[model samples]
Target: MKKTLLSLLAVVTCAYSAPALASGGTEAPPHVHWEFSGPFGTYDRAALQRGLKIYREVCSSCHAVKHLAFRNLTDLGYNEEQVKAIAAEYTVTDGPDEDGEMFERPARPSDRFPSPYPNENAAKAANGVAPPDLSLIVKARHHGANHVFGILTGYEEAPEDHPLADGQHWNKYMPGHVIAMAKPLSNGQVTYEDGTIETVEQYAQDVAQFLAWASEPDLEARKRFGISALIFLAVFAGVMYRLKKAVWKDVH
Candidate 1:
């Protein structure tokens, strides 16, 4: 009878603990297939360009890619002249003048991408929480692309019993299913010159990829080099094996 009671108590404890375990903390974001996921993977230049557009039109208002330079856009298949033209679009504040006052000037190719807000306080004042700098966000987060992708698409209605704080929205993938930022994308949010569908999912995927590239700009080149080195090692090993066989043939 005691064993039966203990077993019943254990089952009830597990039943109660299951929901708590599932929803108690920041949930792992859903996995999504990425073109740049594997050793041989490469970034899609077209997608990066599209993602840049989305970032400029939507995310730039809040989040900032402060470390990525305008010149880095060249990795997205942009030429020098095009990069210069793109860089000219944004103005960033420069050093103090003769009067000891800071001045603003047009951004140059060499300049780091400017933050949307001048400082952390300003960013926080504008949006309750200061938006995170996205420069190394991909590297900073585990399963970075998937996490960002999931967050972008995870906003949804909370269950009836789930309570949310004021100014917070429900995001199943976020910690406690609560987030300060609202859904930032919707259908037809951004029009693609290439005529790709303007969808939240598409935007999330593209921008996530762009962020990945920003985090590891040379990932493709590095992967290529790694592949070349592996090929050379295999060929060298075969040659060495054959040479050994030849050298030992007489002894055998």
Candidate 2:
């Protein structure tokens, strides 16, 4: 009877834990699986710059990463002076000028990243849906990199029984399946300084990595932490081994 009761308790525990794992119940397409690993690889500075250019020119039209300020560019491979110069290239609003009218001036590091629209209603009016904020998207979503890359590259025309009508697409399992965003990448779309062909697949992968980098700017710090942890474990093991040898010497 005790063994049967223990088995029942184990089953109940599993049932309770299942909900926690499935918290982000949002469904994705069939070509992907929910995972936590980010874009675990290195990126070339030139490719990253090109990807940023693509983002600023194309994707920025619909999405925004409000947490990122213009000054944040310094964190990415660039030097501080270069970051300031880049910021100066953009105009931002300041208080009234001598004429008592709001005026624009070169962007400052302290300024927040600008949004495509002034507010939610304006954004919805233009796109028919609210563009999701991308501040922590890479960290929040499952299979983040693969999901981002897959969605960017997996866009296709509608299929029979698709949730969206004819000419509208529905991936096998996406929420509405009919994502409003259209495919933005094309072969040789924006020629890269590195001479890498700008294919849709490459664009997707590079942009996904760039987004992952943005989400966790302290990635190098995490790498340092791992190295420290490994050293500590090795020293701990050595001390334990020496103590065991000393203690068992009398037994032998």
Best model per lDDT: 1
What is residue 145's positional error in candidate 1, in angstroms?
0.5
Q: Mind giving the per-residue lDDT tens digits that candidate 2 earns over 1-252? A: 999999999999999867445543435533432222334434455555665776776778888878888677766677878777777877778888888999888887778667778799888777777777766777876656667776777666676564564334544233445766666677778667777777887777667666776787677667667778999999999999999999999998
Q: How many residue pairs clash in each candidate?
A: 0, 1
Residue 82 CA displacement from its true place in model 1, Å: 1.5
Which ten contiguous residues of candidate 1 have the minimum total lDDT?
Answer: 19-28
List, residue by residue over 1-252, the lDDT tens digit for candidate 1.
999999999999999878658667666888888889889888989999999999999999999998899999999999999999988999988889999999989899999888899899999898788989887888987668898898999998988898877778999787577888989999998999998998999999999999999899989889999999999999999999999999999999
lDDT score for residue 61 of model 2: 81
Off by over 4 Å in 1: 1-27
Relative to the unseen true structure, what is the C-alpha lDDT of residue 226 in candidate 1, on a scale of 0 to 100? 97
lDDT of 1: 0.89
